[model samples]
Target chain A: MKELSRRGLLGLGGALGAAALLSACGEASGSASSDSLSTPAKLRVWFMKDSVSDKAQAWLKQEFENKFQGSTLTIEQQEWDGIVPKLQTALASPESTPDIIELGNTQAPTFCAVGALADLSGMKEELGGANLTKSLVELGSFENKMYAAPFYAGSRIVFYRKDMFQKLGLAIPKTIDELTAVATKIQTGNPEKNAHFSGMFLPGISSQSAFAWVFSNGGRLAVQKDGKWEGGLSSPESQKAIAQLQQLWTTGSTTGTITDSTIGSQPYTAFNTGEAGMFFGFNFHLKKIKKELLDAGKVGYFNFPSPKGDAVGNPFAGGSNVAISNNSKARGLAKEALKLIFSKPFQEFFATEGGWVPGNLNYAAALGQDELSKVTIEAVRNSVGTPAAKNWALVESAKVVDDFFVAMGALKDPVGLAKTADAKMTEILNSK
Target chain B: MTVTSTRAKPEGTLPDRTEPAAPRKRRRNPLPYILLLPAVLIVLVDMGYPLLRQITMAFQHFSLEQQFGKPAEFVGLDNFTRVLGDSAFWLTLGRSLAFCLVCAALTMAIGIGGALLLTKLSRPVSVFVQAAMLLAWAMPVLSSLQVFQWIFDSRSGVVDWTLAGLGMQGMAGYNWFSNPLTFFAVAAILVIWMSVPLVVFMVYASVTQIDESMLEASTLDGANGWKQFREITVPTIAPVLLLVTILEIIWDLRVFTQIFILQKNGGITEQTNVLGTYVYQVGLSGGDYGVASATALIMLLITLLLTWRYVTQFLKQGEV
Candidate 1:
């Protein structure tokens, strides 16, 4: 038995040595001529699942293959929830990295700062020049060099049951306080008539929606003060906003425990059932409501109300940016693909099919003559975004804001929770 | 006596043994070693390299910069120190232990009961029961977890609706994943449901192999079923029980998918983290592979300590 075991160990050692030698040889060969794309190349593009329209994907695939002559572009769809880790590891490896990649506007800074994307500053004029989404441009640029170009933009709007509002004798709220009163009346009256009714389905886990309240009230989640980041949740403006949000949670909400993220992705799911009277969601969410609800003209969108009752409230802007991988072997082909992506025909698809505000405003003419589009454009114009800190994505990933709001929903001490959450946010945002 | 002598005769060993001519080279048999090569190579590559990498990562500052082709600095015990100093790591460790113990105990108790019941059933019934359990055991974890999520969904879920129909109005729209206790309860029930089948199969196979004559003798000695099971059946199948228990403990300690999946919707992140999910959060989400590796090593040591007794017993049995 001992002899057999010893022989097995010897065999294993031999096999491992051979495997290591083979891999070493492979690496040596790969580095021999690594600077340029070889013939018959395959360009791998990773686009998030719901970010881009299907027509755009099909067009890009056909166009890239047609134009490049010898290259193929494969668009791999990725999910947003856990993609940061996937991107970090994938983009770090030259062999594994995709040729073309899409970055969430919030996540672009991290990649750009790490030098994971090729420089796109030279394409500024060719892409869109000053017509790109300004916030996305800011996010995708590092040290005045653009690493990503704007792809599309979206912002949250209040989607209400217009029919229900008239039934309840409530007018569309014009101010934050009036909105609260409407929500309270609807919620209290909802349960008395319907078993599972909610005034506005503002789930506690939906921190981004809650941030609209904070931003409109002139509150920041975190701010760079004295060359260091300090969490702004404890600021009076933020506290007041959180208190209003807390009031909505206590008086206007139905389910306080489940996260809004779960509902956010499919906001129409609840509203379509006629159980939810109002919902805070992106403009495209209107297209996702049940057919019966749509046919009845029940869904109507409006910009969130300002704190002062004088203007549209600013929301947290959400969007995507496209960039080529720095380590891509087919960077030349990827650039050609990017050019195709930014062309007028393809860019207009963002507004025409995907129902998003085109990153290039020139194509936004295609979005003309629709109430949803009008409200969405107004919401997008009025929206503010997260601080341009490289580590804000980490804070979002850590769920600091999400937890704070969810805790607030449970009627926990808003002051105490905000203080604690602020300290955590400060630790993370400054950890950069 | 004549038959025994004939069977033991030297002539009997030589007859029909043309291979005996190569007896001198028999000790150098290459066939068995050749057969073992594939298995040994698989284990060496699949298990050995990753373990080595994990240990190396545990001792180094392997963060995003290192991940992106920069040189990884080797910092002796820094990762360990950070993990040891963090209160959250300790919380995760405690939660992991508590989850494992509870899940393992429940799995074993139900497993033993099912195995006992199978023994008393008729042959056809036993076959049908075993087949049903095998189906459950065969289902993939991902598919089963999704089904469980649907079953307990806050809205339109069957569990809530049924409970509400039973006059439990509070459960009508009860959000199960929101609460840490309820979330783990759902996870535990799913895990136990998936794990019991294997334990039942193992215990039943061993129980059927128990010496029937010994059981008969015990029965004749006026011992009851419970007493016989304790004194005779348990001792006879004690080795299998030890092995199954050790395996269950190890599996339970590394519970990941159920908790991770539920946490996606639960949003109770801080309160519900276990060791596996905590490591993932730190390594991937936090982008700190160094501390995650250190935590993983600590978990490995805990599992080793837990299974050490049974492992040594297993080795001793092999020796005997």
Candidate 2:
């Protein structure tokens, strides 16, 4: 009898404890509003790695704090990997959510559509008006309501070794086919006689880099038809691009089998080793190039060449979009801080310090009139973006496109793989 | 006082004095119950809440919208039916089971062999081997993953370098992670390597505790080493072996870090996903919390079923 009563009491205690905890969780979720514009509330902002330069970060903090007396703004750096899941959980609660978050441009539509971000339709004109990057603005909107603002934009460009070109008596490639021919010639020539040399340091896992070929050939990753999204990899233009990319993998590059994204991002590593004659990378990667190579005038840049040589190829627009979480307690204060972020100094810092095309094109003049800047601005101008579908982030997280290209890089049967990948993409894109 | 006297024995003995003590015992002291309250509360709050939430979510249509304050509609068996109907889930299940069995078997074989060898080694050599195994076991998973990635790297990996130097010129830049077979091979190697030390230590400790007299008795009966082992050591350590095997099966079946980190490096994520990563992909990455919860529940049932017989036998032995 005693044992039974004790067990019952223990069960009752557990039930009471669980009930109390659940009620506590429920109570904390009731959001507190910003009492006044100048109220001293500490704001937390999350920025992705490598997105904001240290100088820009410090300046933003200092400027925001100076403007809003007694209120502290704390900036936390976040990694790009696994950030989607992190945001999904973090943005659900008032206490856990950062006041502002910088998500990848491709991921903005997901957050925007799900109501995780605060609607910024009223402040759109005040932020950048029509001067904001159009594609980014489109990606950061859902049902005509703006949720995120363009942070900055950049695109890949061909960075080749001028010494290698001069040594081999090769002219700058003017078209897609010409680029391939040049790469093949360099690979066969092996001017440095390095056994591990590759004409182009293109890794298969760098699906964003390969997007240049697809977009240049007038193909998209996905397209909406009759209000239903369909995968575009099996289209004629995409197939042709894949064939050309496979040709490059077979004859001009030995880095196609590389599946590591970290290695994919660092194309200049092989270039620095004097083994890679050329690499496709961001203008920001210029800072990462060997100083000796730059001083010797061996480094040169070019926009990705088009197939017909009529225009620059459309590389993927790589950038971020900043948004305030809807769950943020201090929405008004966050808006004020966001105004400082879009100010002239902060916008110009993107060009002068970070080597990215600023989110606002108005401050692009600070990038200087150098050839490198011209190519970078031109690349960003012609750049394409991933599908703005609401579930595009899910597709990316699933890595369907990345896996398909990795197989293509391995010289697999592209036709079958493209069919499978297209089906997967379509299924994911149309899924709720 | 009359009621107490009626409850007690009427004999003029110690029983007459214990009647007062019996009433004292019935007074119900609250100290023990109070002492248990905090522990009970902690367990309920920490583990019980998440479990309750997961079970409830399995029957709901939960997604990112629902996660962000939207109403989640209860879908009854929809999530279960969807997960069970998917071919991908079945494929992942088969792959996970195969990977788990292979890894567990290999780890057990190598661990048991090493433990037996330890019994034969000198004290200093045994101590050195134990220390090395301890270090390997204690090394962080992330640090080991980084080293493994470098070793298997396509461009400058030592594996490719060594293979190329051995006249296998075709392997000079062979990408280990590009192929699914080789990807799982690397993952399985890592899983077994990380887990073998624990198994070795456990088996060794138990093996040393076996009675030496029984082994000598078997040997005097003209029994060979293998025969003595099968007759004496096997039965003596059967319970420990069973427990370790069950633990290995569970650990390997739910192996996450090695496969997940390798899949990130490798491009064959879909082909290489085990059950642990599959749940993560479907729930966290894919944002289908309902279906993921259902799949996780199914995985739990399968694990329970797999270990049910052994667990029962373990309990029976404990009772004995």
Candidate 3:
């Protein structure tokens, strides 16, 4: 009340200012982001945390710098959490966007559908053509245009303590039931000695690992029919898988409630410390175990086994898809870098250095005769992917599978939770 | 990058009023308005544009498609209706409000108590305490969260070890983030720990500003320490108290970094999500900006409602 004169004056000024601001915003024209710049001086790229091997980074930098002299290439590492929002805002602006980026395969569709990536359909042959990881290429495409090229891929295999297995007179499980039985026997036999020991460290929120259980049992997360997507978790097959996983949780896993990858009760840490007899982890986890454990010849791994006891179980194909940013000024250089990433020398680093199956199948055989690589290759060949729904990224982001598995860990009614979770999955997958 | 708008500039750099002018504008000189040109324009462009954009998006059918320069259709109250109808929204709001209130109350109590203790302490000790509080306040949230994570880590946390040593053997290797209740408890402790310092500093500064002679008069008049504190000290610092309270409420209501970071480590996202994280999940993660904006608008209103009383009191005190 005391400042009415000033307030009135300010209000009048603000009204005029608002009129000016509205017109300014209304005139922000669309930028031509996809145009290739001629000989850009600097290029920026982003790689996810720990996604690329150091050797590959070194090779990529040296080669890119050599190919484009007088141009500087910068590689920034990004983290998985909160990256969607970061990418959404950053990729929308040409000035803010990186020239090249490595996208998580699961998140590729969202950016692809939204036209946040440059169309790479014309460069398919240059990007390894038939040698690309089939599932990733399928995932990174939207409306029949390739936006992201398949990068390296990896699949989870079952890692176990060889010493403990021999001491307990257990065989490498060839069937899903035998796997559970072996785990239960080991945990039951030595409960008094190791109070917090687990036969297998299958955390509840590890949806990537838990995905094996669902896929191996012939259950789909969602299915499409006549331009509509519906939840398949309520199906008998999924329920059976959920039941089997819950049984494993109750009987064989002491780390059932552990949720994340790097947290307490992490599979690698537990296995290295002799707290776990088995764990389902990516192929690289063998190297992550304690050196002493490796020196003791205690570590062994096998492919996730099928129910019929003869073949490898279907694993979730985990990987990244390298793409040039849609807003990048140096698309020509970025395309060269992308092509280089798919080349034999660069692709071989995935197997030789990173412990992953190369994105190019031609180089995947370079891992020739290594025990772990053979298992991973077999697993990758048998891998199943999340449904290629346009909104599947939304489903992953929503954490429906993680929630469902965590509920399972808490010993909730599996059938009911799966049904409820199924509905949520359907809702997110069909939102588009 | 382009500066092509006529509204931002006209004729020359300066407008001429020396010649003929409209009758309404003749009495009022436009010099003050011209003086405010640069600052006002900056504010209009910086804060005004996003505020307007958000308000526009809140009513539109905005999603992935519309994000890429595609035209959005006006959806009226659809987003609001969907958010209101969802039971999860209500649950999350209730939890978030309760969490905010509890955190604010605890922070204020600890802060006020610390301030009182500081007033009674020797100069050196008080300075040391202030320094420690400042350190806690100065620590980056991400680094502090990492420390909290280490402290509550199931496998090797000191809290778990100490609790187990005290004969709660079952607490050994206890997962603090395994369940929702435990997750919130840990998060609340972290939030309160980080927030209490500001309240302490503010209350302490205000208490020191109170006239000592007034307290001496009250003491001589048979007013005990508690009595004078309640009668004189309370009334004198009431403005600062309300101001701090208002700020604390706002900070607590929008608590995001701690909860968001912890969610990435463990706990069910559905169980642990507060309004901030929920909005982020829907808008950015789930790619539904319309619902997220509507949710955020509702959250803004709720915050306003909660802080309205304290804010009005503070403003009134300012006038007096």
Candidate 4:
């Protein structure tokens, strides 16, 4: 009986050990060094969803492969939802890291500071040195060394239904207050008598779109004073912006309840469904609007208006930066492919096909001289960017700003929430 | 049963000589040890390594910089101190505990009731119900999450449509994920709905093994159905119940997927965070690995402490 009990105990111990171990598996780490320029190697490139047009991706892949016979270049499209964490893990080891990557311009500083990307300082002149977007260059550089290169730039434009405006005898709003009044008028008018109609599809979770109000009101998300970063959401200018936004949420839109990021990012969806009179979106969302609306000349767009009916408003600059991973085994080959990505044809694709301001300002003329393209260029010219802090990506990941705006949209106590959010932002920004 | 009886006959006859036979049994045998070596080594390499690394990381200042190539400095309980001092950690812990207990209780109650009902149903009906439950259990979590999101969607969802149709005008365009209370309510329902089937299967299997003769005798003695169940069925299935309850508690305490996915749709992420999501947000999203590891270690201890009594009672029963 003693021996039997001891054997049983051994079995039980083994079972428990196995059960506990099943929960976690360590990530494998390995290093490789293969820098031969002539050797044929498969190069993998990662582009964010909706950032690169299919034509651009295909042209780059073909051009690179043609330039280097026997080498294959593959483009993998990744989602933006959790790209930061995914990059953190994937970029840690040589075996798993993609050779080339496209990250949000805002996220470039984080990767650059952490030494996740190869230094591009030597090729700065070769890749458009002075012609690259100025703000993007500032963001992609760390300690005076450039890492990621600006791929493209864009800013939000307000897309409104001309038919609705004509029916309601409304003209294009020229100021922030006038825009709110127009949205409210449309909401109350209910021209189509649709249930759940939003005059402006500005969801609380679309914090990027909401940034237009703050920026146009002379407010910033964060500001550096005496080399110390402080949250700017509680500033008087920002408080005024929040008050105006709250008023819009209360009377101008019913989409304040939308919390899903997917729906928040795609403002054109509600506009296409006829549930919204206007939406703040990128120029590329033009393709997403219904063909019927476009054919009927019902769809129109304009740059975000200023606060006092002055010049154009400064909306958040929306764009991406391309870089080569430091861990790539074929560093030489990756740089060659990156050069192809910035060539005239590939760069023009950004303007012509993707409806974006090309990173190389020289090629932006390919976007044509149409009214829409002119407005898009003007918006991008006046665009503002987030604080160029090293840890700004961490704040984005923590969703502090997004949550603050979401609370305001819900009509919560904005004063208390803004103070709390600012403090959290300060702590994270300063953390080593 | 026949094999045990046959073997016991010889032991019964030689009871006086058992002491002498024990010496022969005590002789060293390497076969069992050799057989266990493969599994033991696999467990150590597979699970033991990660656990050791996590424990070490909990004591060090590890972050994204350290993850790349920087040397991690030993912090020696600094991570623990910071996590414990933070008010957010305490709030998350309290919320996790409340959510876990509520989900486990609801799952168990409904599971047990379903199992009892199955026992009284006709054979075909029981089989149909069991089959339906098997499908629900086998469905992938992501698929179920997609369906549940659709059902509770703020716009064009069946729930709001039905409520509005019933003349609740305000129910139109109601967002379930905007408010924290409704956010958790939806998450709890999803967790319980997915878990109840397993408990039902386990309890039903154990309850069928109960002795029919004892139940018949109690019935003959004019005992009511509830009285017979309390007297006989409870004791017969006590072991299974104890095991199931402990497993449920552990599983629910560390629930991550349902809550994490639902939180993506809800705007109030901080307000709705439980321990699992909190750790993920801090470590993966916040890029602070040290504090996350410390928090996870604390969570593991809490789970073990909560289940210690039941685990000991189970081992004692096994010994008997």
> Sorted by TM-score, highest first, which candidate order results?
4, 2, 1, 3
What is residue A25's positional error in candidate 4, in angstroms? 9.3
Single out the weakest 10-residue window by summed lDDT for candidate 2 chain A: A19-28
Per residue, candidate 4 scores C-alpha lDDT tens digits across A20-53 of 3223222424346465779988999999988889
True contacts kept of 4: 0.41
Query: Better model by TM-score, 2 or 4?
Result: 4
- For model 2, the docking class works out as acceptable
Per-prediction DockQ, in order? 0.26, 0.35, 0.28, 0.40
**Number of the top-ranking candidate, with TM-score as the measure:** 4
lDDT of 3 by residue, A41-153 (tens): 57788999867888888898889888878777888999876677778667766777888998888888878888778899999987788978889999899988999888878
**Model 4 residue pairs with clashes:** none
- Which pairs of residues collide in candidate 1? none
Model 4 misplacement above 4 A: A1-32, B1-27
TM-score of each: 0.90, 0.92, 0.90, 0.94
Q: What is the C-alpha lDDT of each candidate?
A: 0.81, 0.86, 0.80, 0.86
Which digits, one per residue and each the tens of the lDDT, describe model 3 over residues B1-320? 12224333443445453435433443364554665587668765765665577678789888866766677889999999999999889989998999999999999999999998999999999899999999999999999999999999888889999999999989998888868899999999999999999999998999999999999888889999889889988899898888778777877877778998898777589988998888888887777877887887787778778876776676677777
Fraction of native contacts under 8 Å reproduced by each candidate: 0.30, 0.43, 0.38, 0.41
Better structure of 1 and 3 per TM-score: 1
Tens-digit lDDT string for candidate 2 (A290-313):
999999999998999999998899
Best of the two (2, 4) by DockQ: 4
Model 3 TM-score (2 dp) = 0.90
